[model samples]
Target: MTSIDRKAAADVIDFLHRHFPRGWKDWGRDRSVSCTMARKLLIALGHATRAERGAEPLDPPSSPGSLPRMDDTLLALLLVAERDYGFGQGAHRWIRRMKIRNDPLHRDLAASPDVFAFFMELGAVEDGAWTEPAIPALLRYHAALDPLPDFDAVPGLHAFRTNAINEIPEDVAAEMSDILEEERPSLWQLGMMDLLARRWRYPEGWLAASATGPHLLRIPQDALASWMAVELIRTSRAA
Candidate 1:
């Protein structure tokens, strides 16, 4: 449970998503299925080497594939959260029980395609995998964040005002600066996407947003200058 083998995790997900797109289980009553991908993935995660997955009543393994060695934690979590063939309810209970429910780790893991794929399988595993669906909301909140604009990309304050004087209100620049300084968190705000990925980690309004979305600071379109100013301020403060 210390560290998961990423390659092994991906191998497991690819197998299920391909073959058993409907459901995943170590052992089950569905005799119609003669193959399971358990053994290869388990072995990859440093679990015991077993016979190939077959129509066994208990602990079936998967068809032959080269799986790397890894920790069994993620795989075990999936088993606990799988649909009809496994624990069909919430993963939160298991996640909390296992002490793996930290927001920081979940947010970070969601950025990885493999780990995100694993968690995304949550309620939908037995009914079949997620499609007609984008990444789940929980995972999306944790997905790889958008990259920030380059410092050189946003216009300098002087250059901004000279060409776009009429674009914003007379006093908007000072107002934006006050908002940025007042609203900026003393912690991960400047650090993580201007502060919307908290996922119950922070109180509402702690993160800012506009009509465009939470991803952007709450500046309106008419005030793009304010957005530019916000970025410049963030850069200077960072330096």
Candidate 2:
């Protein structure tokens, strides 16, 4: 990946800070306007190539009802990050952390009915899709909502699930393994296993959880490690 020119990026960000001191609200209701503004800024900063700058407008006035294109949305977000938090590795880190935590921007987007609907449609296509790259971020956003959307219906759901499962830190995985191996795993442990099995389509016989009490369940321990390893390997390959 090409490293961003921090100084140059900061200069552009500084310009935006001066113009929009109050954040996104300054841009008004139409996000396309924001995208256009960002595109102009990029061109002025020489950050955008002639080809990019010449690309067709993602939201032409005639298509006012259409959701903003993925490229346009990303450009807008990149500019928004710069406007609110400046530009650098720290800004990038903040964006990634916000995606994971499903806080601030992600939360705000999910809460907006129109924007949420736009994402839902964007996430429905299986191939030749624009939203695949943004699936992980969208999933994280959905996860933060009070009534979580149906993840099974989300486009690229498996990809995000695999990515998330594989990205689990070693220490966390080990702790999970320990908990799953207990004679009577806690309800939380069983619930976690159930979620993994159902969402990732782990073999039913390999690791099954049965509700045996009000808040307790029967969990298999003998094949726990093998089952988890197989599932992880399978998902890693699929992703």
Candidate 3:
């Protein structure tokens, strides 16, 4: 391995330390863990040092090699994140319907937004199309984190209103297909809706005023919406 490979390997070791602060053995590494990891890393990168192929321990001097050329950094990052998410259809892989982390991988992608786009595109790699699964909401989230590359070019961005609670939008077979379940930022429980409904003492005689006057209050359906919700008093004024 070259100096670059050594440096990258050292970085991966640092990542392993971060991942296994209590030590790999504590994390339930089998006796054969070293060989398994080293061999897998080599296979994943399509290159290996003689030492990696053998049983000698992996230290700072060894690396899988040429991560950028192989786009193997994703695999490196996934080593940390694979606990929860990843690509491919294997039951072990599920990153597509999940969120990315706020860790090193996230930081790396934040540094190079184009790289982030490329990684996200891999979620739909089987299609072999240039289209990415990214939607306006996800892109906007990236924007807030200072990673959206073509900021001005990505227009028609709607502000995410957390206070505006809504349901999961189960119409998967409709115009809303582009929206992802998690990226539906319009949905969040303020936790006040039900509380206010149950406990807020309405001002004295407000109900009477509401009864006499033409009052209209429109509430959007939220995750808690069974349509069995108790309606609060509605009021209106003549235009």
Candidate 4:
């Protein structure tokens, strides 16, 4: 980490604190929160990029040796931030996706824009080959934030999207695949159902969304599909 990276990281931390939900209050120390911690890593990376360019730093110091180690939480934050900042007018849409927060980690802080953007960029290779599962939508989301590095320049970006997600177009598949991988994994099924409630305009309450209704032995598939539909709408518009 460099001074700029540290500063940017700090800025992101501040951003998370500012944007973290108050009405839906959760967590202990802000630092203990998974999303905030994840954003911190990203802001740190942004600061590093700014420093490498000899630009004035943001705030805190991001020295190279001080770079935070990347983890799945951090990676998920990166993906989110990338989608938010990378897209043009779609920042709010992408940003909203991360509003669900990391309840399992339930530390305190949650992700912000800067952290998510950096992760998206890091997920890709120089040649535009995505190191992760999908590429097209990732690049689109990343490029959406800012065309700075011009992710569009990466070769065969569409190809990467197509191959990764079946018959769907490359970009669409990539975006869907990444979201499914991150947002709706089996490990997070219950959480996903809760997330679906948020997506579907249900009032808050975790069990309210997941529990069975009259004559229902389990949560209805249609209800689940509705949640997925809303998410799809968000991603599609952003992509």
Best by TM-score: 2
Tens-digit per-residue lDDT, 91-115, candidate 3: 3222333223432112322212322
Candidates' C-alpha lDDT: 0.32, 0.36, 0.28, 0.33
Error of 4 at 177 (Å): 24
Model 1 ranges with Cα > 4 A deviation: 1-127, 142-176, 183-239
TM values, all candidates: 0.19, 0.25, 0.24, 0.23
Which candidate number has the best lDDT?
Answer: 2
RMSD of 1: 19.4
Write the residue-wise lDDT of candidate 4 on 131-164 in tens digits. Answer: 4322222221222223223322445533433332
Model 1 poorest ten-residue lDDT run: 214-223
Better candidate by lDDT, 1 or 2: 2
lDDT of 4 at 203: 18
Please provide, for model 2 over 140-171, each residue's C-alpha lDDT reduced to its tens digit, 9 standing for 90 to 100: 22211145444455455446455667566554
